[model samples]
Target: MNTTHLTLDEKRTLDYLESVKTRLSQLQESIHFFLRSINPETTPGTVAWTELHSKFNVLIAKYLHLTNILNDPRIAFNPRNYTVFPFEPPANDQQVQNLSVLLRTKLFPELEQADEERIKEGTIPGLPALPPSPAPNRAVNPAGVNTPVGTADEKKQWNAYKLKVMMHDELCRKADGIFEQQRDMVHTKVRYESDDGDEEDD
Candidate 1:
């Protein structure tokens, strides 16, 4: 018997949800294209599988985030400006898992075939093996030194904060420049109109 209304905040939240959904759709399409390019009739293998797996996880996180936002008390009862039903969570489930297996068994061979074709056509150089990722080293405290156990983490956090501050300052500077440019443009237009009026009066 009771109807709920969306506040401006709720509407904004719904808009964000829609945007996330759109982004997920774009990502899915891109992965589909990648799969097709690797093998016309099958899915992609190891390297592509891992990459797609990571993407799927990201999408699932976004889906969960949006779902949580929708379920929040402030937003849940409200009649959303956008529909939030029929959850389209990112495709990291059984379907993608099966695809990965198929890629390994069938699509990888197809990818190898395509790679051979590319090599024959001189379009691509032979696939070079990738270098291994560097392992992170733990910082050790010197004997008799009174350094805290978390000092390394603290230092990393400080560095991150410093970088964030620098980026923010740079962005603000760019925004100021843009604002000045727009202001100058408006002023120029006003001066031009004044000159035109003076000419007409003369």
Candidate 2:
């Protein structure tokens, strides 16, 4: 077994990665459980069923991204000599379904509850809602033009790429907002004038 010690920063990164791994496993297991309890034939096109698959696809895509980050070689670190190591990422294209048909096998009740709550309260102000995902194998371009008749793979890739871009842009926007808010905060300095008016006391 090849063992190596992690530096303080690397150890923190590893801890977070481990947590993400656990969450991904739990998420997949929950999805499997939900899938096992559903009747796809009976529930086709139903709101609950459609929504369940939609939510699962989104969550799984997010997990795939997290795993990708964890497996990134550029970020790998070792405590010894503070050196980096090259880590080969596992192949996971099969894990992210090229089509949504696979997700129809599940019903995510937790997601259903969350969706209801979100609908009642509404999303955050000033944030754009996610692009409305279309059914699997079907995608519309921003120009309102339909994809060429038989480019399923291209359509899927385009949608996935677009989704990632949107997610990242939203995150960056939130971060920028946080920085701006901090800058906008009114800061008051309490000053005491010493016996000598010439000297300013901080």
Candidate 3:
């Protein structure tokens, strides 16, 4: 922030350092958040599935970038004073290799597979997609009313959330009105039957 008289290269170096430091802190926080939320023994199902996946993805991305910059031969950046994270600050080359394997080979693959399965099953996230209704003349769109599939995040959002809320309220009000009319009719009929029974008994 105080690079008033520094050279252009010095400014770039400082900026890079700041970026790495910020990313490291974020990586630590995201890792801790996701781990704590997903740990079955600690807080099972505490976090939403989408939230957990998103956070973990961010953590992985930041970790990989941080490690790449730190290990770059050109930069030769040392992380001895950097904040420690779940998958960082390895003591030896073997440990670093193992960490990469654990994440890339083991953990990430399984998680991504699970995510795809969930998306197909419409189990979690923003919402599930409804089945396409058969059309008489035209074929079904396949993209149902609320399908949250695809790459763009715009596809995943509840585009009709407000509209749905308004429709729900309107239906409830109409149903309530009809229900009250039926209840009143039933009550009047019961009263008339009771009066007739009394007269017959007399």
Candidate 4:
């Protein structure tokens, strides 16, 4: 196994990524609480609902800020050494869904492909190539086998990729939940107003 050390810039980028992950985790917890605090009976015009909505908005702003930071060309492309460009978060829910789908189906797969190429080329310095999979005729490995594969450096690279994908998934899931709730609240408010108008006419 190769044992080359990371350069100072790479070390800083990794540290920044860790801090971003921590921030995202905290935001997820806060969003979960926000969702729980919201209820069907919570009217949109009420003080409680307003405060909760304000807090939710702040959380979303922070999330968007983080997204922008991650979308930066420097950090976004650093993982695969500029082979893949990250997607920008869209302004609407439908567009966001499209972006999420694109990431899952296209961008992420490209990153994985880039990793495979890197491993084969031994271009990532200390990371080594993964072993070839066993032939189909070979005995099938039992489920839940805990065998480790590849060198430590190779494992580290794969873990970093997993972490990146996980972070994106977590943020998108939480943000989508919050947006759905907001839409529900708007619909509720509109129905309440319509009912009040009919009662006044009657």
lDDT of each: 0.45, 0.44, 0.53, 0.55
| Tens digit per residue, CA lDDT, model 3, 92-146 | 5574354222232223446555644563465643434423224421111122344
> What lDDT is reached at residue 50 by model 1?
76
Cα error, candidate 4, residue 22 (Å): 2.0
Clashes per candidate (backbone, < 3 Å): 0, 0, 0, 0
lDDT tens digits, residues 90-202, model 1? Answer: 23546434422222222344655554345335353222211121221111111122332345655453344334334444544554675577679768966996788789799
Rank ordering of all candidates by lDDT, starting from the highest: 4, 3, 1, 2
User: Local error of candidate 1 at 69, Å?
Assistant: 16
Per-residue lDDT over 1-202 for candidate 2, one digit per residue giving the tens place of the 0 to 100 score: 2226766876766676566657665666566545644645323444476767876776677677766765666765322211111111212556234222222212455654454344235362322233334542222222233443336655564555445434444544554675565455412111222233336342
Q: Model 4 scores what on Cα lDDT?
A: 0.55
Q: Sort the candidates on TM-score, descending order.
A: 4, 3, 1, 2
Output the number of the TM-score-best candidate: 4
Off by over 4 Å in 4: 1-4, 39-47, 76-202
Stretches of model 3 off by over 4 angstroms after superposition: 39-55, 76-202
Candidate 1 lands at a TM-score of 0.28
Residue 168 in candidate 2, Cα distance off native in Å: 34
Candidate 1, after superposition: displacement of residue 39 in Å?
61
Clashing pairs in 3: none
RMSD of each: 28.1, 27.3, 30.2, 12.9
Cand. 4 TM to true fold: 0.35
Error of 4 at 97 (Å): 25
